[model samples]
Target: MHPASAWLANESAHIEDEADEHDLHAFQAIRRMDEILVNNFMVFQDVVEEGCYDLVVGDEAWDVDYFLHENPELKRFAFAWMTDFVGWVPMPDGGEHEVALTADYNAEMIEQRARYGRVRDRSIFVGSPEDVVDLPFGPGLPGIREWTEANFDFAGYVTGFVPPTQQEREQVRRRLGYGEDDLLCVVTVGGSGVGGPLLHRVLDAVPAARRLVPGLRFLVVTGPRIDPAGLPRRRGVSYRGYLPELYRQLAACDLAVVQGGLTTCMELAAADRPFLYVPLRHHFEQNVHVRHRLERYGAGRCVDYEEACDPDALAVAMAKELHREEHAIPVETDGAQRAGEMLAELI
Candidate 1:
């Protein structure tokens, strides 16, 4: 069972139970293994024991060092990212640190991630594009290792990656009601509920955008965190609530209008889709980590959505990006295999 299974069951048993049942075969097969690694979740920190697994791999979170120190029997590693609450991300043992640099990669942010990683002890530093880690560790995010190398001062090296297959892209496109002659644009919230209301300001332009550009259709993907109902909608707008198939949906689109989440940006880049991204205002990750890197990648530019919410401005923005080139820097897409190997060497 996943670390969060019990809690999900308690909070929403129908969804939770269905999930368990769907993955029951895999769960039974895993139990037959000699060892297993469950994803690290902050909510389960206390409940999970030191001996819960042989290794624990996680993204930036609180008290990582404390958890490892308390459980000396376990091996742990962290992939660093830009966030408001980075705290101290320390990898157990004599391991080096890997940073998945975001769009706004710079001298300051490099030092920031390095500073956080080296709080308790000095360690080797390796950098990959943001896609590698959330555009995440491996093909979970493609083109990240390359993104980091091009813009940042650090060496780009991450061991895992996964790119979507053509078949997968077709499936997602069909699922999103993509038409042969339609210009598909994907709008996303990046799994954070924080900027839902603000995003509507951008979506409000879609009606006019459609009027300006023929054969254009919009898919407003609110992500898992935001409720689609709360967002503004109309008869023709494609408001997809939460489609877990990220790379495919992105690949199917002609352009993307998105929030400043590293994974969303990287996926759009990997899929060769142009977008006008809006990093959340006053957010370190969006404002600093993602804002500055837009021109660097040619994927899209950042918009101060609040100030740029006039539907005309939004329509022009979308029209301008329709012909924009994506992938300012070429991204190497061989992360999944590399990540698996890297994790194997960690212990």
Candidate 2:
């Protein structure tokens, strides 16, 4: 959701309502009392200071290193997400915390080795084969690369993550417009955390695309972070505000005009949908992380924000991508359930 759009209507209430009735699924089939899995490192301090959680599992490739180094005492109660990044973890006075590390490094993680290289040998690191106490790694969703198992303590790969089936495209398309034959294009720029400008540019294309394709319907997603002040008040643009299952919309579309967010690209690819991918300017995740991953697979064409801002340039890129017929990068989807089970075992 958009971080600063609290004034806008909250559409996640339905999700929150569902969560209220959950059995702590996601670490899945959640026990009534279990360790806190910290996906976002920003809340590390809060969970630690409260000292109420039986265990707190830190789950980031890099962020957890700093969090654990600061609180050595918490290590006993910690179950951390580890990767083969080989970064040195700071230990307490010739002593190492028996921290359990889990990694599911896809191809992009292998490519981003330099990011880890900067911190790899920087004195404080305690990363060695022995430092790793391996649990089953993540399901390497969206095509993470594999390294030699001998280099790490003990890590193995599994067909972990789940992707929507090819059949989901029809279901999603039907939900968007029942019994309709309009050529719909889905435009999204990930969550509210990013894509404010990209979305405006996407909306801008709507007017032009309508003229280009007859009976066009634009599904413009305004995430929580996006302020829907200047949304196109056009005939065909459907201003969908922050759908939790936004991927369903992507599956239903004839074409996808998206920014470089891996999960978004993966979902569209799962549905066998082609897209015009516009990577965010100077953002590593967009330009570097998912960029190499997607391009390597012949999944989509790249566009710069500058070119996208120019209507003619974006149209050319969009037109070029639309002409291409096939796009498929297979990703494992069982990681959702497996990752949950791994976290659940943290206690």
The numbered model that scores best in lDDT is: 1
Candidate 2 lDDT, tens digit per residue, 64-129?
444355444444354444442232221122222211211322233343433342322111111223
Tens-digit lDDT string for candidate 1 (211-323): 87877887788777678888766645777777876667777887888777666776776666778787654344455444434444565777775545788888888888887
CA RMSD (A), model 2? 13.2
Question: Which portions of model 1 show Cα errors greater than 4 Å?
Answer: 3-52, 66-171, 292-295
User: What is each predicted model's overall lDDT from 0 to 1?
Assistant: 0.52, 0.51
Model 1 error, position 62 (Å): 2.9
TM-scores for all candidates?
0.63, 0.62
Instruction: Indicate the worst ten consecutive residues by lDDT in candidate 2.
Output: 21-30
Score candidate 2 by lDDT: 0.51
